[model samples]
Target: MIPLIEARGLVRIYEIRKGPFSRPQPVRAVDDLSLSVMPGETVGIVGESGSGKSTLGRMLLGIDRAQAGEVIFDGRQMPPLHSQQWRALRAKMQLVYQDPLAALDRRLTISAQIGEPLDIHGIGSKEERKERVRELMGAVGLRPDQAGRYPHELSGGQRQRAVIARALAARPSLLICDEPVSALDVSIQAQVVNMLRDLQEQNGIAMVFISHDLKVVRNIADRVAVMYLGKIVEEGSSDTIFQFPRHPYTKALVSSVPVPGKRLQGRVILQGEPPNPAARPSGCAFHPRCPLATDICRTRTPELRRIETGRTAACHLLANDLAVAA
Candidate 1:
């Protein structure tokens, strides 16, 4: 089956201006990345902050145009940003912002905000839009009476639910959720994550769930992609990748996820500072911090290579077993 969305060789670069005498430095937020999401599939992208996960999400949605490569949606190339074609096509996809308070308009009631998508997409009449808004509120676990309240009137979880209800207003087939539950309390995070999973199952919507939390991603994603320094170091079925992470970066990230009722042992502690986009290291971008870094890792960029059926990783030491590396 054709993918609901496909991004090939996506590259997004930004310039950092320092001073009048200094030349601006170019930074690649997303570099040579490719990903695809099948219909009704949930793909989780996990990485620490500044790994370009957010940039990739914006590129996928055409909110931030890639400097190189292309994004195809439903067998068609993504139209130019803000074009009439893009505007109309947008009804099929939606974004769940990380901060619900910022995402929602304080001036508008929840009912109006949730129903705005329908109005923009011209999906239904006024009465029908109102009915759909109520339906979505219920679906996302928001009360009908709460629809008339402003964003600040609700708690963090309630605000997030309102955002989800708004995103579902047009019945989108694809949802690009960038750090959807990162800002919520731990308990609220579980509720939102489970709610998102249930919503996807019910509506058959494909989702690219981006977050830094591996435990949360593991619970919600069917497949997982681990990103580091603007590239996917490893990707596979969530069970396989999380249980047996291949790349050093992936291993470090997975080890950091806490397991309840047990003291963690042999956790891969990361070294050095977080990756600097403005001054990206040469060769393997992860070598500076990877414990398994050898001479080859410092000199050559490893291509993402297939390890087994439906699994791939970019690492110089893939031939050796992970135990040996440790």
Candidate 2:
């Protein structure tokens, strides 16, 4: 079966503006990343702040144009912004941002905010639109009466719920969430995450969950992808990634997760911050911090290769000492 969403050789570069007479430097935000999402499956993408997870998320949802590469959904190429095909595809894909307040229009009422998409798509009559908004509110765990309130009137959790309601109002097939719960309090984060899981099960919608928190991703993702310096270094089932990480970067990231009274032997602590995107390192991007890096790693780039059942890693050490203990 074909994947619901497939990205091949995806690359997105942004040109930075310098002062007068200065040449613009192109920053490679996403460097030839490839990903596929099965129907009704949740794929988790985790990395540090500048790891390009959010940029990939935006490209997946058609919110950002790819400098090179293609994003195909259900066998159709996604069109660029404002094109005829893009207008039609927008109805099937939606994005939920990290800061709900930033996405929400503070001047508009909740009802209008939710109803606007339905209205733009010409989904239903005015009365039916109002009813649909009410149903959407209920779907995201908001009361029907809350539709009249402004965004400032609600708490952070409520604002996020409202944002989810608005995204669902479009009846999108794929939902790209970019750090959806990173801004909320610890207690409320669980509630939002659980709500998303419940919604996905009920709607059978495919999701691309992008976040920096591995713990949160572990609870919701069936498969997990680990990225570093704008490239996916490792990807596999969540259980395998958390329990038996093969890549040194994956091992170091998992070690950082707090586990009370449980100390892992030979835990690897990654050294130094990720290199600048403008001037990335010569060979393997993680070589600067990889304890297993060999001389070849510093001079040659490692291609992503299949390492085990349903697991892939981009590392030159995959031939010998890369085996993970069972």
The numbered model that scores best in TM-score is 1
Candidate 1 lDDT: 0.90
Candidate 2: residue 305 Cα off by (Å):
0.6
For all predictions, the C-alpha RMSD in Å is 1.5, 1.9
What TM-score, computed on C-alpha atoms, does each candidate reach?
0.97, 0.95
lDDT of 1 by residue, 1-326 (tens): 99999999999999988898899889999999999999999999998888999999999999999999999999999999999999998999999989999999999999999999999889988889988998999999998889789999999999999999889889899999999898999999999999999999999999999999888898999999988889998999998888877777888887777778657666666778889888888889999998878888788888887877889888878844443254
Residues 136-170, model 2: lDDT tens digits? 89888888888899999999999999998888888
Q: List ranges where model 1 is wrong by over 4 Å.
A: 319-326
- Mark the regions of model 2 whose C-alpha exceeds 4 Å error after superposition: 17-21, 260-267, 320-326
CA lDDT for candidate 2: 0.89
For candidate 1, the 10 contiguous residues with the lowest summed lDDT are 317-326
